[model samples]
Target: MKNLKIALSLLILISVTSCDDFLSEKPDNRTEIDTPAKISELLVQAYPQMSYFDIAETMSDNVFDSGMPETLRKNEQSYNWDIQTETTDIDTQAYYWDACYTAIAHANKALEAIEDLGSPASLNPQKGEALIARAYSHFMLVSLWSKRYNPATAASDLGIPYVTKPETELVTKYKRNTVKEVFDFIEKDIEDGLKIVTNDYKQPKFHFNVSASKAFASRFYLIKGDWDRVLELTSDLGSKPVGKLRDFASYDLLSAVDQRLAYASSDAETNLLIVSANSIVSRSYYSNRFYLSGARYPDIFGTATSLFNKPWLYNFYSSNSSITVFLPKFYEYFKYSNVTAGIGDPYVAEVLLSNDEFFLNRIEAHVMKGNIATANDELEYFLSTRTVGYVPTDKLTEAKVVAKYPVIADEYTPFYTMTPVQTSYVKAIAETRRRDFIHEGMRWFDVKRFNIVVNHETTNKPVNTLVKDDNRRAIQIPLHASNTGVELNPR
Candidate 1:
């Protein structure tokens, strides 16, 4: 019995160590977090290292089966809407899930330290950052793992556990909160955090600065059907966000590598929050079988698809095959642990929040508020930035929007009600966003929120369809997490 107990204890220790947060590192170093500077440094890890761009993008309507021979299980699984079984691989949902909680742990530790130090007024910024970081991670967790937030059903929907405190026990089991409970917690954190959050960091873009905080809040409220709050949060960004938006026209001139780096660069005014994500998605540009291929590329990027009847200003590069094509958004920066061996981990600078998205959220808010003219104007201005040879004459009208996106009945059914005109305008905005954030994995959230059906075509097999309100819309909880007593989303 003694020997068996020892063996089991060792097994548990190994499992704990293998987990993302063993809670014994620099960020979680309880002793080291005695000072403010250390706490600030700790909060750096508060942003998730994992990338959801690939997973989300694949699951959305943006990518198609290229019929390419090269295969990545994660990409293929996501494209088919299958439960992602790969638990530890970068760019997988499970990795992202672990990454989120690992990030939350860092935030929780920092908050605990602040409380331990008597919660000085000087530590307000740190406290605010920590709270918001916690909220952001939890928000992401629920957004991806739980059912889309429906107010009527959210109270009963399963949410990822909202972990607010540092783990004191090694094998602490967690239970899933309901969607409403999770949102309530996230709202409380965001509200508390925003009240005291500051853009005081040396490199503010990497952190949840004032703009990033508002941008995040804009998305949260946008999902919650709080149109007025979304509009208010993003009000300062101005209707014509010329300088704040991405300079896609100039980006078109840069080299492919430069374009990749520039898209998520701190130098770019649009990128509000950037994180160095531990990801291999950039490398998957060509190797993955499921990808943005020539067949689907033209329909997405063609002039006919654009309301302005012009080519998009996006920088697209074809792989060596000229078969698997992709946008130059995610650029991998490798960090070598052993220089002599040429071994390293791949990292991509991912834009978590941006002014471009913030502006779109504003435009959508306008549409929801029955401000059709204002929404049209803003949408025109936003698209002009990304349209090739965009002239002032290329205008946007409700007529054009309706013609472009003639509402199919029951096509888009969000929680909020909309007029037929409003629905058309919203669909137009969604299409624009779908193109804008092609590789960013944001489209998946929209797919969930709008309850849009998706069809995936395979060369040999029959078409796989994800119908509206399909239970599979909520990605299954990671197996490891579920094994630890967290309930899985219903299949």
Candidate 2:
């Protein structure tokens, strides 16, 4: 009993130890972290310390000028593809470079502390989480500052520094690795973590419980083009009588605002993990709902001469749903928060992983492997939740989904200047992701992985446009870390 009490007390201290503090200096050697229980406290924070989506969100096609105020200047510049927008000085949004490494540092410390504990079976769970946490952090870091992992060019492309040791002095100086090396390290960590991780966690949703860790692994394999591994991981989920998709119809959709909040609720069955990021209150685009047509904002449904002219292009929220006309559609602002989000969002970002993502991941894998029948079944299972009155029993087809959820419609278009979109199963997946994971910045990862060129425009007489790619795709390393030899990505 006394030992449990001591471990809990150490954990509280660990939780309060901000990532910044850990990065700024080394831990005192005298502090006792040698025991498994004490080491578990450090592993409690295996998740990324910050929100992972903002800058990438601005760089994607999901957002538009929408006439809403940009809470921060960086958001506007980012959306415009201004080369100098995300300087180290602007700390408004979560900085991927620092946040990711900080997470790695925590994981490394946990592993190092438990090294001499002999990694007995009793200590496997802690060791598993630490290893997985380390891999997840590096995966996020390389995903952003470095280019997407492409085998052909990865051998030559520069990757983010992959930190392994918990020692601060070692982390203080580092060099970039090839993209392939970062991916190899991530894979190795997952293997090591999976071997030790237990399927059961006391707080399953808060940590990477058995199912959640599998889900994370499935995500990684999908990106690596390993369809068989994805299928193997999801084999159990495939035959379950009730797939893990959230039954949106079961929610009170009669009230759109209430429903949006309900979908993102803490206890919502859709969530596998729950984490909240601070809402950047200053950025208008971050919380905007305005979409203009001509000099005046247009109504969702046209009346009289032009009847029933509704815009279509797979946006999360429609004009009618967002009560605050200028607020971003699809988000439910039940309350306000004061925390800053260079890490993640306060309430909305908390619903990071869910059954919805798993279903989509399986569907994509099935499609890639040419199992169209299986893929269709999974897709139908998913649409039942998102589309009102959708019947999953009927055999659904790719054509049906594309028709019902077309990105472009006859009468109205979104406020952005768009290039032609291809109609394929992949596009279908991207559109579904944009809707299912809106506002949370989940769509940006797909944008980078596929190198989807998104163009943004200013509503001026001449109409300025920025075609985003190249240097804009990668983030610049923060100046704080620059003195220590971490090379900044070309911006």
Candidate 3:
């Protein structure tokens, strides 16, 4: 207990002192004399910090893809399963947790400083942007530290502490809030944010634009099952004057495949916010040099082998003796640049948040409400645009596919029956999303969200189950948070 207390004291002291470098810098008249711009710069710092929460490094590669060796094509696991910890490496979790809190603390500092500056109206858009950034930081922290958003269970589940002010004193203890409270707070922040940050601005390549803020809100709405709001916000996304996906044939597959992908690449017209390559490269460097290299089990494919070695497999490989196995999607996405590239454009491909996803979300709601026909039509519409050569009216029936290509899944299951249209929709969404997003960090979330049973297609058998409440679902809360008396999610 004494040692723990001492450690906590040190942690708080470190947190407070870490920002001294920035704080110590000579303040220009703008920062010292003016209030709003200083707050805006603080908010800007908060935005780039989110790129530190890389889904690939922390969640996808560490958790969802960890099991791919046995389930996917050609890989081997030399270490016993016991060697695998929950969600991510202990060190990795610590790093992410620290990064998140650091961001939160920075935002908190801005908010704290702004409070003394004057009334909220005095700061205008800057105050709103600061709040938005703080809320986003908290949202990311809780999403990683807590379980999936289950409106039913969230009221009871533990969430990260909602710290609103910078802690200057040493050894401040905190406790968890319920997930419901966390999300409620996040929603309130977004509402507040929406009111202030109305104009678009072009600044550093790494900062969040106004459209990106809306995109984040759109994502939040989608996750919360607010279909109307999602549709309303995403409706104007792909229209003229915004952005669109590049034509499939026009994609420079070779060059684009291995490069570190930002939110928007050069070809993208509507990507709202993309993490810069510097952030990616820095994180990737840490992951490759430390975490991946130190992993106990050999990759299934072979260490040091690229995931694109066979794009069809979509799994890791082992080199004969190397410690690293290339993620094909990661490789493909960042193929154009080397490790040291600076931040790229935020728009890569206008991530069409499409009416399709909205349609599917509505179908899901309808299925939950037992409206079968409406669900089926909506499902069909979503599938039609997804499958390239097919017309929008092409039926997605099992019989049609079985008749056309003898090699598809066995018996045709109707959209109703024991194989619920909901199930079909989930599968369709998963498969289509997997193909479309590739390395964009959406696949693993699909696996977790739907509790999908991943199977080894080569072996024609169920491989493993990834669901909430499973060990696979719980990432270790950063040691710093845990040490500070913050309650972590149960495994």
lDDT of each: 0.86, 0.58, 0.46
| CA RMSD per model (angstroms) | 8.5, 9.2, 11.4
Model 3 misplaced regions, further than 4 Å:
1-34, 48-91, 120-122, 238-243, 246-248, 253-267, 277-419, 453-468
lDDT by residue for model 3 (1-491), tens:
00000010000111111232443343331133235656665665564332332343334433223322322110111011111222233223454455566666667667777778875675656666666677777776676566667777879877778877766455578888887898898898887877776454554223444555666676676567665665565555332221243233233243323222432453344344434222232223123322233243233222222111222222333332334333322221222223355322221112323323333444454544455565556555444433334454455553432232242242222212324344444454444454445434455455444443332211233444333355445455655567678765565
Task: List, residue by residue over 4-59, the lDDT tens digit for candidate 1.
Answer: 00110001101001223336644344355688877887888888889988888898
Report the C-alpha displacement of residue 371, candidate 2, in angstroms.
0.8
Instruction: Select the stronger candidate by lDDT from 1 and 2.
Output: 1
Per-residue lDDT tens digits for candidate 2, residues 429-490, read 66667666655567767877666666565555344343334666666665666678878777
Best by TM-score: 1
Ranking by lDDT: 1, 2, 3
Winner on TM-score (1 vs 3): 1
Residue 336 CA error for candidate 2 (Å)? Answer: 13
On lDDT, who's better, 2 or 3? 2
Could you say which candidate leads in lDDT?
Answer: 1
What lDDT does model 3 reach?
0.46
Candidate 3 at residue 277, lDDT?
Answer: 23
